[model samples]
Target: MSQTLRVLGTSVTLLESIRQRAEAELGIRLQYQVHDTQTAQRIAVMHPERYDLYDQWFHNLDFVWPARAIQPIDTRRIALWDEINDLPKLGRLHPDDRLAHGSLPCDRLFVQPDGRLGSRPGTQISMLPLTHNADSFAYRPEHLPAALAGREESWSWLVDESWCGHIALQNDAAIGALDAALALQASGLARFDNLGNLRLEEIDQLANCLIDKQRHGHFAGFWSDDREASALMLGPRVHIQSLWSPTLMQLHRAGVKYRLAVPKEGYRAWFGGLSLSRCVQGPIKDAAYAYLNWWLAGWPGAVMARQGIYIANPLRTRDHLSRAEWDYWYDGRPATEQLPGSDGLPLIDPGEVREGGAYAQRMGHIGVWNAVMDEHNYLVRRWGDLLRTAR
Candidate 1:
């Protein structure tokens, strides 16, 4: 009998494509019910026993635990759980490229192939990495910031004194945390110094910049939503901010011009990978594994690239790609078939992704990052307060 796989995925624009892929894989076609993340969370909790797998933005790992709504993953039962064969290939995946299997974060205390890892919240040997990416500058105009500095182009220039207040940034920590960390890193103001864990001081810097720019009448304001950011940039209230490719692609479809930049110091990013659900039964698990392997090998990456959304699996090579295709896939080249000006040419040398200095996968680690950033929200709220007080 064909086994059924009940999975949850984000309702982002990629929903349709992801659904089609699952249908093709399961043969029986998955019962994919799309909902906002909140609804998905409720479904996961109410029917943990019923779900074969709960697909989410990896950030779901944060709530998965506190809500106590999941089954323990059966590592021994997973048919493809070959350590020697899979771990090396997966473990060696670019640290930020946590979207692949077999890799763990910094060997921290988790139920991983290595041993008990650290205290990074739900990452305690639970959950799995699904997809990962580095946050970089996505812009148009082709005026490379690093080049203007007599340096290579970079997304980090938005944080510099020269740029002052005109910048774009994502409000979601998972999406924009790395970009904040890099901006702070450039100013020597931010680092993983807090608790020796990767940290980002996003709010303070943003507030200060907001205040500074207001004082000089040079600041435009930090963007809180992707659509809003794009609109502002289109209206030209904002010129730049860190953005992921999916949104950039949509903007391109809207006829907005821009490019993606993997800065010299490296772009900051977070990623997730797929792990079979402990609740899954029947041959579906093997099929899921097949899908996972295929995804890891790069079908999803290629598809995402076509949509201007970059996924992690570097080895996941696409078939019959032209130079323009490669640009959109690996080099941040624009989807030239549409956005002719956006040829997302490489701005700087970010080194190879296979090496370290890239993003590290933090499976089931949404809570830790959230707790840290929640305190950071004081700054965000404070920015609002400042605008209010001024009025």
Candidate 2:
């Protein structure tokens, strides 16, 4: 009899192709529960018994680990652990670079001897590093304001009054709040001592700033997922907004003239991985490990690469991609020819170069990582208030 493992996560990795491949090759039945970021995080923390595997971002580990919702993953059991990049082990792609702010994956990677999470390398880890990307907003050049014609791309444009009533933002507290704070600071409207961890007063300041903007019709709307963002960006409804990699790909396939900005202020980065539920054991636990190992085994990473996401062990994925694909996606070369997306349709045309150059070049300039802040509970309450009142 085939064992079954249920995975809980947002749409990032709960993709149909991944699920089908895992079921076919591993001989295990897989069930995926996809939700918006907050809903999925809540269930993973509050209802650990509902899923056997957790497929989500590393930032959520702040709440999930402390609550005992997920168990440690032994690195020895992961087939590609040895080949995983140093980014998760050292917090920086290179040893000399300063660590990016927020809940970086490396900071919570290793399982300490005291049974808590820490950076010290050990036999066990909090999550298996899988896919990641440096994210920034995408905009339609035709809708860009005249005043900003010669200006380099910057986060400040998200709040600039010239573009008021035409900009959309991601509608989550943790991720969206960071984007807002960056914009507010870039626009000289507000300041935060640490972009990653906001004090209560800082949260209030952000809330008030956004509230004032909403009252004046500065924002077009808010989006909870890439699909919603895609709709908002289509036509003339929205000209600029926070965007994800998959959404960028979708817009391209639909013939939207979009450019993923290389903001002067840098990008917001996120890393995603898999973890086991606290309640899983025996046969199910074994199957969970099997699924985790499969993600780093090349094919899945290759699929995500086509969508512009970076795998942990990109060298392994390199083998599965074409020469043109490897050059365009990882090396940041202009497409020598058209390139297909994960769906195997031409998504990138020749002569187009990736916005931010190579993998190292893009990942090097992170402004912050998505985080569960120290005052996350308070942030959530105020964030809900802003969304409800703004709408």
Best-performing candidate as measured by TM-score:
2
TM-score of each: 0.61, 0.98
Model 2: lDDT to the true structure: 0.90
lDDT of candidate 2 over 37-117, digit per residue (tens): 879988999999999988889998998999999999988888779999988888889876668788889889999999999
**Highest lDDT against the true fold, candidate:** 2
Candidate 1's TM-score reads 0.61
Give stretches of model 1 more than 4 Å off: 1-6, 11-13, 29-52, 56-63, 72-125, 142-151, 154-156, 160-165, 174-178, 188-232, 252-255, 275-298, 308-391
| Residue 232 displacement in candidate 1 (angstroms) | 4.4
* Candidate 2 backbone collisions, by pair: none
Q: Give me candidate 2's TM-score against the actual structure.
A: 0.98
Which consecutive 10 residues in model 2 have the weakest lDDT in total? Answer: 382-391
lDDT of 1 at 87: 23
